[model samples]
Target: MRFRNLLLSAATCAAISLSASADLTGKVTFSGKAPEPKQIDMSGVKECADKHPDPVFEQTLVVGEKGELANVVVSIKAEDSPDLKGEPSKDPAVLDQKGCMYEPHVLAMCVGQPLVVKNDDEFLHNVHSLAQENPNFNFGQPNKDDGKTVDQAPKTKEYIRIKCDVHPWMSAYIAVFENPYFAVTGEDGTYAIKGLPDGDYTVQFWHEKLASTPVEAKVTIKDGKGELNHEFKAEGAMAPDTSDVKLASMTKTSEKSCCEMSKKVEKVATATPAAKPADAQVKAAN
Candidate 1:
């Protein structure tokens, strides 16, 4: 009993230490001009007909000349980061379905934490996480007013697509990072991470739309506080509004690509995957 108590105490401390935050913030902007969407009229169109009548190419938002960037997934391995906060985040992540749209369209919740799946919609909907990084959950929510919570296995992922089968059009992505130090850009394009221990480390920048060459960067960071600006030039990157946001950069030291998960983390991945990206139509970064 004493040993068990000691183990529990150690786990609790690790959880709290991992939950500590280090303030780091910045903006992601594009150099090229933002393309204006050309709305095409399909007055006379039919595919699925009664089920799916007028299908419009959803307008996507991308980084522009002024550079509006958000949802750049960042991750760093504990080995790559010396004296780093190696423990994962214990906070619960909320993914709510309301009015056929997923709130917090892009999320960066840590693994092993409770993922709160909410449904405020008036219709029955199911959550199907097309996941490879974590154990997949594909259950229906027959009730609308109330919702359910699910536990997610621990794993490092680029991003996983989630949707409601009943409402085919509804979609969202949960970008899970093994490291606790990850944040999603906001509307104005600003991100801040704090409470970091002093040491050398590498940080990554991942954009869903804009594809940068390096995929990730190798940097030696000292403790205290530091700043680095990462600009994703639209001209060189994938059109934000058109294609599936591809990989940008990573902090991997080996020859693997920036988007590739390190072997240390990949060993924890789920063996089988469930669904793929919905519609083959990619959603733009928020």
Candidate 2:
């Protein structure tokens, strides 16, 4: 009886150890020279233009002075790790529109995660998503403090494009994953994904400018710690958005009432420039 009890205790300890989670630290650095900032003509929207006394540069390819690449999404491709699936966080994923730009520029969230979109700008803005895997959504937030909670969670791993129909320059991307092991690189190009069980994982790094890059790495974690580092070539790699926004062609979808905005948005999207390729469309940097 004593021997059996000891064995049972050992098994319990082993099980507890196996269920422990770890932290994964990563950084995405840019190689070669940083790209020149592209100027955005915000004149079309006086409200947005007035906010910027000088020129407002595009964020399509933001690189730090020391080669730090911002807005790069780093996520674990846990296709084989069924047990590593994490429960969706009760806190909703936030996407804010301020100063005529999407804050964070790139957002990564877990599948089935709630999304909260807020318009912090005084000017009217619309949140329109060009989502393929998930059902599409388009809504207008006219009031400065207006915010809408997107109750439905995305059911698939996809990169959804969020745009403002009223301000064509306003764009952002949301990448959803099966698990919570994802992080968006900050301005310093550093990211950390925590709460990963000990195992092998395929980490995928994605950026709007480096859409074609096979930015993936395989790493094995043990003792609750792992590190990943990736570098993207910045020489002629920054894909700036020089496309012209023909406001004349894009009527004021925001002006329409909530009931009629959806119909007008559909008409406006059809007239916009042909969408970039699927991978390229994952995010809009500029």
Q: Pick the candidate with the highest TM-score.
A: 2
Give, for candidate 1, the lowest lDDT window spanning 10 residues.
Answer: 277-286
List, residue by residue over 1-286, the lDDT tens digit for candidate 1.
Answer: 3432332234311232333333344566655565664433433322212323444332234343456565565555444653343344455678887655577677777655557788775556788876654677888776664446785543654467676776655657677655566666775566765444433445566554543212444333333344444555444345334222232122112334434211111112121111221101111111
Q: Show model 2 residue runs off by greater than 4 Å.
A: 1-20, 212-214, 235-286
Q: Candidate 1 regions off by >4 Å? A: 1-22, 37-65, 82-90, 152-154, 211-214, 239-255, 258-286
C-alpha lDDT of all candidate models, in order: 0.49, 0.63
Clashes of each: 23, 2
Query: Please, what is the TM-score per model?
Result: 0.65, 0.74
lDDT of 2 by residue, 1-286 (tens): 3432332233210112223456677667777777687798988878898889988887777889898888888776666455455567666788999988898688777776678888889768888876666777888888786558885556787766678889988878788777767888999988877666556776667776664232445566655667766666544455444343321122111122111100011111221211322221111111
Top model by lDDT, which number?
Answer: 2
